[model samples]
Target: MHDFDFVRPQTVSDAVRALATPDAQALSGGQTLLPAMKVRLAAPAVLVSLMHIPDMVFVRADGDVLRVGGATTHAQVAREAAGAYPALASLAARIGDPAVRSRGTIGGSLANNDPSACYPAGVLASNATIVTDRREIGADDFFQGMFTTALEEGEIVVEVRFPIPDAARYEKFIQPASRFPLTAAFVARHSGGARVAITGASESGVFRWHEAEVALTSDFAVQALDGLAVDADGMIADLHGSSAYRAHLAGVMTRRAVAAIV
Candidate 1:
């Protein structure tokens, strides 16, 4: 990779101050960023590591919401979050491989907002809050599009607050080689209603399937999804799968998630 200065600060304030330097980028797990740097897809004059900051790496259950530190690794969540949100823990446990799970941070994944990433689906469906150094952003408003978010330049994700639901499930159909979801659904059932989020299939990125949510919220059963069809117009189409196939999977996965919850 290109030459760059690296700094590991012990506090959020220190890290934020370091990031104020021009051309500096925040480094969390480096699962995505380091690979890009290796390929010259991304280059920064300075790398500010957030993992060194103690406040940015933790998992805590706060009443009905689970507060997860932004720098918390997937493995930690997979282990620590089961008591608060089992479905989310299950999702974390299946992301990529052991190495990727150990190094990748939730903050990095949400910040990058990769369309195929699993966390966005969970966060969105759970109606979680994305807390940053600047302000808190609702999940509905946080994800802008594929690889895009509402975060301004130099903003840091501090933590995510996920409101635990009455019941929840995430079903993912993954590409064998990459282990990234080709199509996935996360369903969360609350007292008021249900929320459904789909990922890995949308050309526009992760989105809520309102029809399924309404149906599931009304019935909370697999049979409730009958007659529901996902439109393929805006789905991702490539060598791996067709837009039609992905759209079909979106519906199928949502049914599976709801079935699991039921």
Candidate 2:
């Protein structure tokens, strides 16, 4: 990483002001940022660390929302919400083992918006609210594309808010090397409906599967989605697997997630 001005602001307002410049970047868990920086892909002139902010590393239920702060690590999520949000907690626990989970934050995962990451699918399926310093975003609007999101420059994600669902489960096919999901599925069934979201398949990034959703929505049974096929047009091709293989895994994981939820 190149030499940069490091600002450890204690307040959200200060962090916002500090990141007002175009070259400034927010540093959360540094799980992705540090690696990207090492590869010389990220060379921010100023790095604003969100760790010092009070309440930015917490997880609790407020009103009807399960709030998880941006700086809150995956280990924290796994510990705090493990029983409450089983699927989300399971996903957090499976995030790069004990060491990475200890360092990787929920906010960091959301901020990086990696196409292959677990949280996006979990958030979307759980109908979570992505609360930023500026505003709140619906899960659908939060994720945009590969390494991209709805986050504006200088606008940082402060926390994530998820509504309690009736039941939820996550199933993933992880790549042996990086451990990122080759294809991951998050399924949540509430009084309203059942949502199914897939990660690590699409080129444009995380997306909800409407087909499997239809089956789960109609009948929450695993066998209900027997022949449902995931559309592969939007999926990405990679060395880990072909587009066809990933699309197949998307359906396989979708069924498995539905099974796990029930």
Candidate that scores best on TM-score = 1
Name the lDDT value of residue 98 in candidate 1.
96
Least well predicted 10-residue stretch by lDDT in candidate 2: 81-90
lDDT (Cα atoms) of all candidates against the true structure? 0.95, 0.88
Model 2 lDDT, residue 132, Cα: 92
Question: Where is model 1 more than 4 Å wrong at Cα?
Answer: none
Give the runs in model 2 whose Cα sits over 4 Å from its true position: none
lDDT of 2 by residue, 137-221 (tens): 9998989888898998888889999997888889989886888899999888978889989999999899989888888888899
Question: Measured by C-alpha RMSD in angstroms, how accurate is candidate 1?
Answer: 0.7
